[model samples]
Target chain A: MIIPAKSRLWSTVAVFAVAVGLTACQTTGGDAYRAPINAAKTQTADDPDKDSGAPTDVSGDSVARDDGDSGITGSIDDYRIEDLSPGERPDISSDEASVWMIADRAERRAANAGNAIKDPALNAYVSDMVCKIAGDYCDDIRVYIVRVPDFNATMSPNGMMSVYSGLLLRARNEAQLATVLSHEIGHYLRRHSYQRMKDTIDKTNGLAFFQVFTAALGVPVVGSIATIATVGSLASFGRDSEREADGYGVLLMARAGFSPHEAPKIWENLDAELGDTPRSRSFFYASHPAISERQTMLRALADEVPIAGGGPGRIGTEEYREALSPHWESLLADEVSKRDYERTERLFDALIADGFRAGAVYYQKGEMYRQRGDEGDEDLALAAYHAATQFIDAPPEVFRARGQIFQRRGLNVEARESYAEYIRRNPEATDRKMIEFVIGGLGS
Target chain B: MKKLVRIAALASVLALAAACQGYTLVKGGSPVEVGNAMKVSPERSWSKLTSGKYEIWTVDGPILQQILFASGVEDGEKLFPTDAQTPKTLPEFKKGMTELEITELYRDTLVQLGGTQFEIQEIAPKTIAGKQGFRFEFTFATKEGLQKNGIAEAVLAEDKLYFVAYTGAKLHYYPKNLPDAEQVMGSVEIL
Candidate 1:
């Protein structure tokens, strides 16, 4: 299948189109040099390749007439970037509906984090400020703030931007957060997700059918998308979508007046955080080129536009830590879930060093120990639980572990006391009845 | 034509089943006698689960089949604990069980491998290995965007509670393995 370039016309035509616009960027010795900032401004001006300049070579012309209340149209600035309408206007309100769906999902996930950690005040604070920074350039897209410790974010098909709490924690300053947020906002303004969804809808019918069939037929589809989307996102918006998202994100970050340089730095930090796993490891950052290449391009761009304003100095590292202190343990729970032992261990050590107070950390540490019941590490396992109990506000799990160990050693009274304490502390814990029974059995 | 093809497929499976009748042990060796009963142990030798990397005790039985045993003379973590909740929950493999602890025990035995999203669905009582048991199902959202369910049943038998947990991609899992799981459950006997 012929892959359409951003101009949406076949590459043969795009090559010619680029040859014609060759005056925009000066090529010296076969290497492209950063054009003056005005060149970008000039190239994006009233060029015929204006809004939605993707190729008109769209073969299947099934038009889903958008609910036509002239949906968020490109403002004068939007006209500067190529108009990114994938095909005919989809229902305008349909976009809103989707944004609400994703935002609702984010809210539900936030609810899952214990109330102590999930703070709407914090979510509102970040959302309000971050949107103000990026929205100055893109549309006022709705942002969903989730309470997770992983530094990740995704812009769905609609204008729903999900900002993981981990991203806030990891970012050193407001400019860094702005760089990341702008990249995601760029996804929406550039219409990457919708274009991808549309392009892949027909092609991925088989995989989608398989997934739907498996769900209907009662098969586990968990962690098996390798058989579905990974093979070829063609039916869904393939690698092209990711590359497009990255390019647009960088462009948006630059436009938003944040240091575009931080975009690549954010990626490099992510790579380091993840131990530089190769790009092909999982489809998470599917479109991200090598970290070096991204940094190279970002640096080139930064050299072109020396922002009049210097870096937005690192924002509240201490305040970010304090705001997130409550959920430090639960976020560690995510690390355990992802099986990033190296990262989980590091987070565990950091939390201990930082003197954060939370019952979840102790519980998670206890869990880590329990998971590590390797030979000769029984002592380590025991120690993890002991540390879990040292927390000022220990969860019932701490008592349960102590109780289980005591019972195993035939210390029935100690076990009974521990179990009873657990029962008293976590009256509503899922395993309450079970622990009570164990306590009763000890008495028997 | 399609109907004929399907019937032929079914007939072929039936024939294959008839061809492989009766119990078979690894290397076709004699069944190991434990207590008063003979049992098929996949732990006959080194496993391929983690051929040279790590070891996990993974036992693949017929659909619905349950394998029972301990790690060594020293008790290892419970394979399927009596109590396990979902989402914010964990596999009751036992206290102090490491990633290697569970993954290594059952090496390369699980087919149709998928992730477990431990969400507490429901907890109830059921019969497993002819003893009092707790049956808990862990619910996980699958990559295919479906919720996969795993039912783990643990029962105290032969001075030990055998834990059998079965998780499969829905369409071809529980239905196909339920009968085999039942047979394994029935065949279980203590020393």
Candidate 2:
């Protein structure tokens, strides 16, 4: 059950009280936000938008220490991507095990959802391009083309690379995709995941980090134990990992012959896409350098590489748009469900403006209206839904919405027919049960 | 000159080998096996399974590779929560289900976990425990080196219906583990 916002905060306080009560004997760290030690806090806790009075500086310079600092020396060689096959690389026994587990779990969940694209051509294109640019540095890495509409990429500790579909959509060319992928590759090579995990353990557990890893249960088990058994609070690693990845990613992009400046440009788009969303994704905050910070870094790094004469860099723009064309309506539907009406409406208008006529746009407009309800213009919604149904290939959602409209207007038979058509078309839909129940309520 | 060239090649090989020496990768050993088959059917009055206790199974082969418990089991109910009012959000349980909704449920989970692209193999009808159901094969890649591949069996039986999901790697490792999973499925019985 979802807690009301006020109660949620107080519930969190209660949870905090229980946690403190449970761990009262343990020594509290200086200037530390006492970690909640309860199952409720662990599983259901949301990532807070602002820091809880914790001191953090997200600048790139924080991780780059002087030469005498443990011999790291900020040398170029330290960040080079080591060429190691999957079997050759050392086990990530020291990394944040929870993050890897979550990533793995997410992958499994994706596979289970049947949300994968079966296009071998697209997969091969991405894989080939990524390897050509970054393969020499690492060999055991795996690439996945996820069907998400957001422009993002993530590199997991286990060398699992997930590229969002939106990235494919937004990139000006193959070079742009390579620039982002190369940047992520840099994160893996620089051992950011491992370091972050270690840093988390160090900060939270103090001297107990060594004990946790060396337990008789084994490291993976220890990691899982930490996540499952202990309070799974939001564990953001110290700033070192993000800066390291950013620095290394920029270098990789530059070496691979893409404009390093594109990295920051990507972030600028990302920030705009986010608009006024209160909290940014944890991965972006956790792993990626800030957009402004990254933009500045990339501009400075641009000095090392030649600013080449321009070419028509609209790499795969047409193909990207074409491939996504079939799923445009569905993607819009998904965005609408997430209550991202602005993005949904914008995309709808873009498709219409791009000559995608027929009832798809009209129907989507109607769907957006219904979603808005009291917060939206209902008259426009009714007009759009009616206009949408006039098309030859109207989707089940349109019929369903029309059915709801009919039901509201006291047209029982018409509503039943519409609902029936919707149910028939979307037999595999998640809402089938509810629709069936609704149809049942309409009576024979 | 030939002898000198051979020495240089050997030196380079040794250097490469040394660079790899830092990683003690745990690899092939005796193949792991599922010793006993246990079927978990929701029909035989589930007083034990959903008793708020996580059931963990211990097996051997790979380190830390243990069979975990599938929590919150019930007949004709979803393992995870979805909006009940939204019929389109959940699929139809026709006949009642051609394929278990595990794939469907798992995909939803992925989106929550920041999955941008998720997909699955085609689903078809099948039978388990002498009742009609469906089988779905699926694969996914993520930022971590975890290539999770899975198959789920949604079966029906007298007074009970449920699904069994077996997941492992998409590589050579999956084949090695499938038999163990099968053995476990075979072992499971209403308890």
Best prediction by DockQ: 1
| Candidate number with greatest lDDT | 2
lDDT (tens digit, per residue) of candidate 1 on A12-101? 111211121111111110111111111222112222111111111122222232223422221222223555443323455863343234
lDDT of 2 by residue, A144-245 (tens): 776555556666555667776656654545556766787667666654555544544444564334333322122112222232212111122234444455
Over the stretch B14-116, how does candidate 1's per-residue lDDT look in tens digits?
3333322322333322333332222433323211111111111212322212233332211433332211111112233444332222332222112112222
Going through the candidates in order, the fraction of native interface contacts each one reproduces equals: 0.00, 0.01
**Per-residue C-alpha lDDT of model 2 across residues B147-185, encoded as one tens digit per residue:** 556665555544233545554445564575676656555
- How many pairs in model 1 have backbone atoms within 3 A of each other, for residues 3 or more apart or on separate chains, i.e. clashes? 57
Candidate 2: regions farther than 4 A off:
A1-44, A48-88, A91-122, A145-152, A164-176, A201-262, A281-289, A296-314, A323-400, A411-444, B1-191
